[model samples]
Target: MSFRMIAQERPGNPWFSWDYVQGNSDTILAALREHAALTAQAVLIATVVAIPLAVLAYWVRPLTGPILALSGALYTIPSLALFAFIAPYLGTGTSTVLVGLVVYALLLIIRNTLAGLNQVPPEVRDAARGMGYGRLAQLLRIELPLALPGILTGVRLATVSTVALTTVGVLVGHGGLGQLILGGFRNNFFRAEIMTGTLLCVLLALVLDLLLAGAERLLTPWSRRRAEAG
Candidate 1:
């Protein structure tokens, strides 16, 4: 084969390439947007579902064991296996991945929520009661606010976890950046493509975690003040 043919046949697959990034900017951005959207949706739904369940488990002590067990069990399931199991019923799309992500998130959020609620000092509850705060009022105004930090911690963890797990959604054609990673492997181990996807996933997780941390600081300014005082 001529030199030109040989070069064309075995194109370079550099580990990092700004040229490749510029060429595929649209595709990369689209995948990133989808990844962010899926992670946010999954975490939001999980939080909504988890808070109520945590409250219910908190009040009805007997139900706590079962609820925690079920969520923990769901978390224990392998991500790929869980996706495969759901795909048969959900038909392999964003829905399947969303459901799986929500399932995976429940354990952390629920556990943290319950922990936060339980951490509310008995004296604090008594003080609220002394102020004529009804059960519902105390829970909403005092307990939930006090628990916000812990709940946000759980959310932060779940968000990071979901970002990584979202890549698994590629099995269902909704893997977002995962598509690039898989494509890289399939297309003769294109390092740039693989690195782009991998690095983006890591960056997304870091950015989300930092944002949540900032939110926690904003929402629980007292905690920051207390830390400074201590």
Candidate 2:
């Protein structure tokens, strides 16, 4: 049976319909793939950039204010405006969306990284120094490990936020599931398409959060042990 036939039979719009899912499985999956890819790319790039910036800020007192201020300023820009502004230079599509998502992610990740590093007790640094661990070694072995929980928490938050904001990329033709959502509204309020996109986005966020939580547990076994003991 055709989609038109199915729609004619239904007459009234329903929130969901197996016919829609069956008819548009390929398109839906493609959009899902695009959304997931864009989100992952944005977050990964943000993490890479944020870590270095966070580390620099932590070590350089003067840079702390500027780095944080810049990130905060970027965060304040509305998603739609930011994408629109970048579209002229970037020429729309995935790059514009990717850049905007990365900008949005930076503040959260940077702040969390700073918080994590600061929470590392002074005595731990002293002990590492006493053990002849150099600045880099101390950071890698002691400070970063201790700071993992806070850092991972920030990543989890940033990732979830990115997933939601990714929908906004539809304005530039790269909104992943957002495309479906917009399409639904444009095509006479097709509830099935809208619901599928919305539900999948929520599902993606939850799944990513759970995966990150598992990673945090794996990486910070000592924290888990302490919690268990407590």
- List, residue by residue over 110-131, the lDDT tens digit for candidate 2: 9999999999999989999999
Query: Least lDDT summed over 10 consecutive residues: which range in candidate 2?
Result: 1-10
User: For model 1, where is the 10-residue window of minimal lDDT?
Assistant: 1-10
| Model 1 C-alpha lDDT per residue in residues 130-220, reported as the tens digit of each score | 9999989999999999999879989999999999999999999999899999988787678899999999999999999999999998899
Stretches of candidate 2 exceeding 4 Å from the true structure: 1-10
lDDT of 2: 0.92
User: How many steric overlaps does candidate 2 have?
Assistant: 0
> Which candidate has the highest lDDT of all?
1
Query: In model 1, how large is the Cα lDDT of residue 209?
Result: 95
After superposing all C-alphas onto the true structure, candidate 2 shows an RMSD in angstroms of 4.0
What is the alpha-carbon lDDT for the whole of candidate 1? 0.93
In angstroms, give how far residue 133 of model 1 lies from its true place: 1.1
Q: Candidates' lDDT values, in order?
A: 0.93, 0.92
Tell me which residue pairs clash in candidate 1. none
Number of clashing residue pairs, candidate 1:
0
